[model samples]
Target: MAQVHLRDVVKNYGPLEVVHSINLDIADNEFVVLVGPSGCGKSTTLRMIAGLEEISGGEIFIGDNVVNDLPPRERNISMVFQNYALYPHMTVRENLGFSLKIAKRPQAEIDKAVDEAAEILSLTPLLDRKPGALSGGQRQRVAMGRAIVRHPDVFLFDEPLSNLDAKLRTQMRVEIKKLHQKVRSTIVYVTHDQVEAMTLADRIVIMRDGHIEQIGTPLDVFENPVNTFVATFIGSPPMNLLNGVVRDGAVVLEDGTTVPVPPGYQAREGQAVQLGMRADNVMPVGHSLPPTEHMAQIEMDVNLTEPLGTETLLFAELAGAEVQAKMLNPRPVEAGERMTFQVMLDKCHLFDAESGAALRG
Candidate 1:
C-alpha cells in the first residue's frame, strides 16, 4: 500500500486542456473514488495518476517518490480497465501470469501467483477458460485477478463493472468491496454512478468541467452540497430546488407562500435566491404545527407516484418547478390533488441565483 499525492496536476491534449490544476492527497490503503458526469475529467485524472496520460504540469508522488517521468509499468501500479482488456486467445491462467512471465519470474513463481489470484477472485474454476468462453462478470474478475497477481502498490479501476447487467453490477459491487477489504491496497476508482461513489468510496471527489467541485465523504456531499450543481447531482431522485426570494428573513415562493430560513442564511429581504431541499426531508403535514425558525410550509400538487417496494416516490410541482418527495409507508395519493408538505429549513440550502455559489452566513 502507498500514499498517492498530486499537486497542481494538469492534463492537456495539444490545445485542449482536459484537466485543470488538481491537488489531492490519497492516504495509504484508502479507497478514493472520483465521480462526475461524462467529460468531467475524472477518468483523465486517474489516467494521469497511473502514468497512462502525460501530466502537462504539476507533481505526482507515490510513496514519497516523484514519478512524473516514469512509465505505467515503472510506477509499480496496476490498472483495471472498463472493457476488461483481456486477450481473447489466452486462457485465464495465462492472462493472469503474463506480467510475471514478462518480468522473468520463474515458472513455479508464476504458477503460484496465478493460483493465489484466481483463488482470491473465485476464478480458479474457470482457469482454463478463454475470454471467449467467459461471461461479462467472469471476464471482469479475470481483469481484477491480473491486477492482484502483480501486487502493485496502487490499484486503479476505470468503471470496471460498467459492462455487466444490473444484477451482476450489484453482485460485483459487493465482490469488489470484499476484495478491497482483503487486499487493503490503495485504490482510485472512477465512475459516473453516484450510488457506486456513495457505497464504495472512503471519500468522493466530485468533478465538473475538469475541476474539483467538492471533496468529502458521501454523507457530507449529500447533506450539505456547496452549490446547486452538487445538490442536484449526488441524490437519487435529486433534491427539489424551487425558485424563491429571500424576504423578511425567510424564503418566499413565486406563489407568495413562505418558508423559514435557518440561522446561517444571511440573504437580504426581497433578494433573489434559490432554495434547496432534499426529497426525504419533504414531509406531509398531518396537523398544524407552530411555525419554527427552521421550518417552511408548501402546497404540493401531486403529478404522479411511484411505489418502490419499501417507500413511495411522489412527483409534484411547486412554484412552477418540478419537485419530488420520498415518503416512508406512503398511502395512496391521487393525481391533481393539493397536498401540504413541510420543508425542513434547518437542512435547507441557499444558493446565489447568478453565481450559483452557496450563500454563506
Candidate 2:
C-alpha cells in the first residue's frame, strides 16, 4: 500500500475552475471518500488522481513518485468505473488477466495471480463465463477482480456502485469493505450519496462549489458541522435550523421563546444566530431526563407521522416552520394535533445568521 498526496490541485475550463486548490494527504491503507453534490468537483478530483482529467495547476503524488505527468496507465492505479467496463468478448479469467498480459508478464505468473484473485473474490466458479452470462453483481466483481489482479498501489473508485439497485448497492458496500479489509489497499472513492460516504469513509472530504467545505471523520462532521451548509447536507433527515437571536446569553426563537446557550459561546447578546438541532436529539422530554438543565420546548401541530417499523419520525411545525423529530418507538400519533416536544440544549449547534458559519461554545 502507498500513500496518495494532492498538493493544491486545480482544474479549469477556459478560466472556469471546476476544482479549486484542493490539498489532501491520504495515508497508506486509508479509505478516503470524496463526497459532494453535482457540479461540486468531486468526480473531477477523482479523475485528476486517475489521470483521466488534466490538472490546470498543482501536483499529485502516488507513494514517493510525482505522477503529474503520467498517463492513466503509467500512474500505476486501478480504477473501477461506475459502468463496470468489461470487454464482452473476454471470459472472466481473460478480463482479470488482461492488464498483466498487456505488460507481457509470464503466462504462469498471470495464471497464478488470476487464480488467486478469483478465489478471494469468489469468482472462480465463473472464470470461464462471458460478461453476457454474468449477473450485475458478478460483473462488478469482475471489474474489481481485474483491479485486484494487478495489485496497484492505489485503488480509485468513481461511483462504482451507482448503477446498481438499492439492495445490490447495499450488498456491494459490505463486499467492498470486506475486500478492503483483506487487501488493506489505499483507496480514494468518490460518491454523491451521503450514506455511502458515511458508511465507507475513514475520512470524508465534503466539498461544495468547487471548494472544500470540511474534511473530517464521519462522526466529527455529523456532530460538529463547520457551517449551516454542512449541517443540512450530512444528515438523512437533516438538522433542524431555526432563526433566532442571542438575548441575555440566550437564543430567542421566532415565536418569542428563550433557550439558554451553552457555556463559552463567543457571540454576544442580541446578535442574530441560527439554532441547529438534530432530529434524534429532539425527543419527548419526559421519556428520559436530558443531559442539559436548560431545555427548549416548542408546541406545534403534528403535520404527519411516519412509522419506520423500528422508529417513528414525527413531522411537525414550530414557529411557522417545518421541523422533524425522531422517536425511538413506533408510537401512535395523529396529524393536525398540537404536541409539545423538548430539544436537548447541550446537543444543539449554533451558526452565524449572516455568515452561516457554525458558532462554537
lDDT of each: 0.88, 0.89
Prediction 1 TM-score vs. true: 0.96
- How far is 105's C-alpha from truth in model 2 (Å)? 0.9
What would you estimate as the lDDT of candidate 1?
0.88
Give lDDT: candidate 1, residue 107.
98
- Candidate 2 backbone collisions, by pair: none
Residue 213, candidate 1: C-alpha displacement in angstroms: 0.4
Instruction: After the best TM-score superposition of candidate 1, give how far the Cα of residue 355 lies from its true spot, in angstroms.
Output: 1.8
Clashes of each: 0, 0
Cα error, candidate 1, residue 291 (Å): 12
lDDT of 1 by residue, 294-339 (tens): 6767788989889887777889988888888766766787888788
